[model samples]
Target: MSTPRHTLAQLCAAVTAAPVLLVAPAAVAAPQAPPPSTVIGGERLGLPGVQVDPLAGAPALPTDLTGESWIVSDATSGDVLASYNPHARLPPASTLKILFADTVLPKFDRNAVHRVADEEIQNIGAGSSLVGIKENLDYRVEDLWRGVFLSSGNDAVHVLSHMNGGIQPTVDEMQSKADALQARDTTVVSPDGYDRDGQLSSAYDLSLFARSGLRNADFRMYCATREAMFPGAVDKNTGQRSSFGIANTDRLLGKYPGLIGVKNGTTTNAGSTFVGAAERDGRTLLVTVMHPASYQRVYDETAELLDWGFASAGKVRPVGRLVEEKQAGGEQPSGQAGGTAGAPPPHPAGAPAGPVAGSAGDDGLGPVGWSAVLVGALVGAGAVVVLRRRTANRAGRLWK
Candidate 1:
């Protein structure tokens, strides 16, 4: 089923706050001004933005974007603030490790040491990113997580999987944990986000996983480190002591304030994927992108969204200016925005509760599984039915 047919206003209210359902005695017809032209790449395109209100007369959303898919979210609340095709599934590549980290971080003792097993390196070869883990070398779980995030180490995933149990069981746990987190559109075929046929995820889910990652101070530290040292030995073959120096690929950090560590991923099939976060003014933003033309688009677009978020302030408005009368279910004055004196300002239309951006679509390459593709649709549809019914029931009781 498609997303539940909530008006933009209703959706914001439902997701962000309860609606005040009193009917207005007189419904004054408010005129809708034609939407303003959108600004794209600093040029007005003359394309009309979606009209959200009549009284407040907010301008159109900027159309500047280069990513095929993206999401920007409030890291603290997991509220998606803006999205573009959020539910679309795409190859997540190494970004899939975000889910892998989520499952592994809580189970392992960060300070506990994991012996790099020969089996952990099984079938993993030179082409795959590695932490230079010499066979039988011991490394702390904390370092492993860093290698996973910072180095994009497939071997680190394998080590964690073995520590968690066999690879199959770790994959199973990854799926279970993703489901529990309400990341329905995500699936893990491999512990590391290697390009496997059945593996896929959406920007929406990555944002969710990134938000969860932020909660772990250890995990956050792993992502932000530009470089780290793991105590390990020399390779016998070359008689060289392999220095395992890892740098985070997430480009947004340091360049952007409140930038936090997430992860970056790319594969022959997946193109490029990124899950990143930044904080400023007590608000944190989660940004995720998949299948972009180049890795830089993910970072550039994310920086742009972060800048937009800072310019806006929480404004409590009068009811007429708060919501569009036509879209207000006939219960509010026309074209008026309203809010209680101390209530948090309601986000505008097109403002999602999670990422400031999100995307889903065919990566213009090949077929993705229908089951994986439908996960978001089914979840959204199902959630709306359940929530709306419960909301209606409660509304009925309050009326009586």
Candidate 2:
């Protein structure tokens, strides 16, 4: 697709119109109620269009940033470093998988095994990315997660959704989980994030999803895994299952300094979307870039924002903060990530020891040769509560 003729001019106009602020950033909250609507964090954040609060000595913010929307924030402090149309709703592509992972990762012990069935894989959307999942194959819970994190496989996502129940159930749960996180800009019409009429998410909401998902250790490990050996079909002659390698789709996983795991997505409808995390000197930053005009620029713009965020760290005041999980419009942990009291242990008997080597096939950038491949969330008492109870009841049958 050709670049839009007026994108640069519009962006420059947005920057020139933004205000310059020098006030110290502060944390604000009203635990007794849902998030305030004025500005979401402060008045500075509410202004229409792109909002960039400049620091006196800090070098200019990236001039070449391109995307429909984007955000950079400090994971620990929740300070929104910078944004442009952060709340604009757009197709999330596979980046929405972060929320899917956050909602489902804590429910099952990684060792739990499930055999894929025909119905489970029957309904995946066409032309979507896939990790080669086939019917009647038995896979550990951890294996399915790797397909998701690495290959961005819709097939793997459908299998996992069936394990949780079914597609509509998982979609409902995802929507409720998004609501609980105050990510109101999202609509969960499809669990695998394949484009649908009503499905959408904003850069702000996607960041919240990534921040929450990163709190879980399993979620963290899977996203950071650059490569892994995925189970292959059983040899009919010997009845022994073989394995093939898969690599994480996230481009920055190894090339970028301090870059941690996250996710990325691309589709004709959504363009390109990505949410990435990195740790530098004990400080972690989260960046989300959605619908960049080109596949490569999505990554380039993200890296640029991250660079600006790190360099401008102490110099700029935060425009907003990522809201905490809430209940009845108040602070609570019932559905919190990595903290659900009744959730299964992070690791059980069959947990993965470590990731494997990179492969020649799909790495989320482009496909190479070779075969092999394949492809969550909650509701009620917040989604986690319902999942916790269900997981407890289903534990006995999990590995059968």
Give the alpha carbon lDDT tens digit for every residue of 226-338 in model 1: 77876668677987655556677677767788788788887788887888787777877777777766767767777776665444324211111101112323243443332
Please give the lDDT score for candidate 2. Answer: 0.75
* Cα RMSD for candidates in order: 19.5, 26.1
Candidate topping lDDT = 2
Evaluate candidate 1 by giving its C-alpha RMSD to the native, one decimal.
19.5
* lDDT against the true structure, each candidate: 0.62, 0.75
Clashes of each: 33, 10
Write the residue-wise lDDT of candidate 2 on 94-135 in tens digits. 988888897778888899999898988887788988889889
